[model samples]
Target: MSRFTELKREVYEANMELHTRNLVIYTWGNVSQIDRDASVIAIKPSGVPYEDLKPEHIVIVDMENTIVEGDMRPSSDTKTHTHLYRHFESIGGVTHTHSSYATAWAQAQMGIPCFGTTHADFAYGEVPCTAVMSDEQIQRDYEEETGVQITDAFAVINPEEVPMVIVAGHAPFTWGSNAAKSVYHAVVLEEMAKMAYLTKTLDPSRAPLKQAIIDKHYMRKHGKNAYYGQ
Candidate 1:
C-alpha cells in the first residue's frame, strides 16, 4: 500500500463525518489532513458527493498545492487548505463548511460573540470574521486569496486558542491538531453560532460575555492550567 493510504483513509473518514454529522450538504464542504513529515496534505476531491466518496478519492497535495497523488482533482478550496497548513504551523487539519447557522453569521459579516461559557470553552473569545476580499483578489485565484484573508484576520489572535474563523460573505473554516479534531471544532462552532443567534433574538440588549468568565472557561479547557476533559 502507498504510504499515503493511511492519511487518505483518515481524511476520508473526517470528510465523511462532516456529512454524517450534518455539517455539510451535497459537496459543500471539504476536510484535509496534513502529513507534516511528508510535507503533504490529503484532502477531499473537488465536487464529489460525500456519499460516494472512497479513501482513494482523497487527493494528496503538497504545501505548494501541487497534486502529488490520486487521480482526482483536489478540492476547489485546496489552496486555502495548503496556505493554512503552510502558515498555521500548529494545525494539522483544516475543514471548510457551509453549515447554516455559521454561514448565516458569515453572510452577516459578523463574528460569533462570546455570549456564554459554552463558546468560551472552545474559543478564548469571539470567533472572528475575515475582512472582505478586495475586488482584485476576488477576480484572481479567489481560493488562494481566501487563504490569505484567513491568515491576515488572525494577525492579533492566537490560532491555537481560537481554531475557527468565518469568511466574510462566505462560511466557516476551522482547524485543529488533526482532521477529526478540525471537524469537531466545526460542529462546536455551529452549535455556538446557533446559540449566539438565539441569544440575540431573545435578548437584543444582552451584553457580550464578561472577560472574567471568558478567561476562566477558556483557561480551564486549554493552557497548562487546563482542567477540562479529565
Candidate 2:
C-alpha cells in the first residue's frame, strides 16, 4: 500500500466537500494537506473535476513542489500551496475557492466587515483582502506571487486568529490544523461574506459590529479562557 494512502484520501474528501458545500464549481478550486514529518502534501490534481476525482488522483508533492507520487499533475496553484506550507509553519492545510459572495468581495477589493457575531466568531476582525497584485509582481511567477501577497497581508495578522483571507481581485484562501478544518473555514467564510453583503445592501450607512462585541464573540470561542464547545 502507498504510504500516502490516508493523506490522499483525506485531501480527496476535503476537495469533494468544496463541491458538495457549493464552495466550488467545475474546476475552480483546490485543497491541500501537509504531512509535516514527511515534508510532503497531498493536493487535488490540476483541472480534475470533483465528480471524477478519486483517492488515487490526489497528487503528493514535496515542499519544493516536486511530485513525489501520483500519475496526474498537481494543481496549477501548487506553487501557492507549497509557498504557504513553507511560510506558515503552524498551518497543516489550505483551501482556495471562488465561491460567489467571497469572490465578489475580492473583486471589489473590499474586506468583509465583522458585521455580527457570526463573522466575529470565525475571524477576529474584518476578513482581510490582500492588496492588488502589482504589475511587476504579476510579471513574476504569478502563482508564487499569489502566496507572497497572502503572506504580506498576514504580516500583522496572526494566521491562528484569522484563518482566512480573500485575495484582492481573486478569491478566498483558508487554512487550518488539517484539510477538513480548512474546508470548514472556507464554508464559514462564504456564509459570512454573504451575510455581510446583504447587511450592507440593506443599510449602506450601517457600521461594523462594535469592537466590544467582536471581542466577546471571538474570545468566548477562541480566547485563553474559551469555553464554547463541549
Candidate 3:
C-alpha cells in the first residue's frame, strides 16, 4: 500500500511552487498528503529551502506524527496536520502558510468577514480566525501550541465544510481531499484575504454574503449538485 515515488515528487514540486510564487518565504510553510490505503502522510521536511528541496526529502508519518519512512524530519507543523487528519474523516491533505494579509488577520485575532464575490466563492463567507490564545498556551512553544489551538479553534465551525482556519497569533491552514486542492485553497485563501483587507479599509462594516447566495455558491461546487468539473 505504499505510494509511488512519483507521487512524492509531485508533492515536492507543489511545495516548491509555494516559495517560487512568493506564497511563502524563509522556512515558514508546509504541505502534506495522506495515503488512504496506508494511513500515512508524505510531508516536506522541516526548514528545507525550496531550491534545496528534493522529492526524496519528503517524510512519511503516521496519524500520530511518528515518522515511518524517509531520511529527514517532517515539517515542524506536522502535529497540526496530524490533528486535522485524525479529526476530519474526508481531509486527505493539509497545508499551512503565513501568506501576508491572512497572517495579518490571524495576528489581529479577527475573522476575515466575507467581503466580495472572490471571498465568497472560496470560503462561502468570511474566513474564520480563532480567538486569541489562552495565557497558558501563549507561554508555551508557539508552534506546538498552535497545533492544540487550531484543533480547538474549529470548535464553533464545521471543519468538513469550511476546510480552513487561521490560528490566533499564527497563520492560515487549509485542507482538501487531496494534495493539489489543498495547495489550491492555500493560494485562494491568500487572494481572498487580500481582497477582504482592502474591503475593510474602504468600508468598515461590510457584511457576509446573504445566506441564499452563500448556499447557492457552496452547493454548486460541492455536495449533490456540484458542477465544477467532470
Candidate 4:
C-alpha cells in the first residue's frame, strides 16, 4: 500500500461528512487534506457523487498542481485549494462549499457579523467576505485567481484566528489543522450565517455584538487563559 493510503482515507471520509451533514449536494463541494512533508494533497475527484466516492478515488496533487496519484481528476477547485495550501503554511486541510445560507451571504457580498456568542465562540469578529474579483482576474485562471482574491481579502485578519471566509458572489472556504476540522469549521460557518441572517431580519437596526462580549466569548474559548471546553 502507498504511504499516502491513510491520508487518502481521511480525506475521503471528510468529503463524505460534507454529504452526510447536508453541507453539500450533487457534488457542489470538495474537501482536501494536505501532507505537507510530501508536498501533496488528497482531494475529492471532480464531479463524483458522494455515494460513489471511495478512498482510492481521492486524487493526489502536488503544490505545482501536478497529479501525483489516483485514477481520477481532482476537484475543479483544485487550484484554489493548491494556492491556499501554498500560502497558508499552517493549515493542513481546506473545504469549499456552496451551503445555502453562507452562499447567500457571499451572494450579497456582506461579511457575517458576530451577532451572538455562538459566532464569537468560533470566530473572533465578523466572518470576512472577499471583494468582488476584477474582470481580468475572473477571466484569467479563474480558480487560481479566486484563491488569490481570498488571500488578498485576508490581509488584515489572521487566518489561524479566523478559519473561514466567503468569496463575493461565490461561496465559503474554510481551513483547519486537518481535514476533519475543516469540515467542522464549514458546518459552524453555515449555522452562524443562518443565525446572523435571521438576526438582522428580526431587528434591522441591531449592531454587531459588543466588543467586550466578543472578547469574553472568544477569549473563553481561544484566549491565552481559555477555559470553555473540558
**Candidate 2 residue-pair clash tally:** 0
Can you write out model 3's per-residue Cα lDDT over 102-129, one digit (the tens) per residue?
A: 8998888888876565665677666777
Clashes per candidate, residues 3 or more apart or on different chains = 0, 0, 0, 0
TM-score of each: 0.98, 0.99, 0.89, 0.98
lDDT, candidate 1, 133-225, per-residue tens? 999998998999999999999999999999999999999999999999999999999999999999999998998899999999989888788
Task: For model 2, give the 10-residue run with minimal summed lDDT.
Answer: 79-88
Q: Give the Å error, residue 221, model 2.
A: 0.4
Model 2 quality (TM-score): 0.99
**Candidate 1 segments whose C-alpha is farther than 4 A from its true place:** none
Candidate 4 local lDDT, residue 79: 99
Residue 179 alpha-carbon offset, candidate 1, angstroms: 0.3
Task: Write one digit per residue (lDDT tens) for candidate 4, span 11-56.
Answer: 9999999999999988999999999999999999999998898899
Runs in model 3 deviating more than 4 A are 1-4, 138-144, 227-230
Error of 4 at 213 (Å): 0.6
99, model 2: CA deviation in Å?
0.3
The residue ranges of model 4 lying beyond 4 angstroms of the native Cα positions read none
Tens digit per residue, CA lDDT, model 2, 90-121: 99999999999999999999989999999999
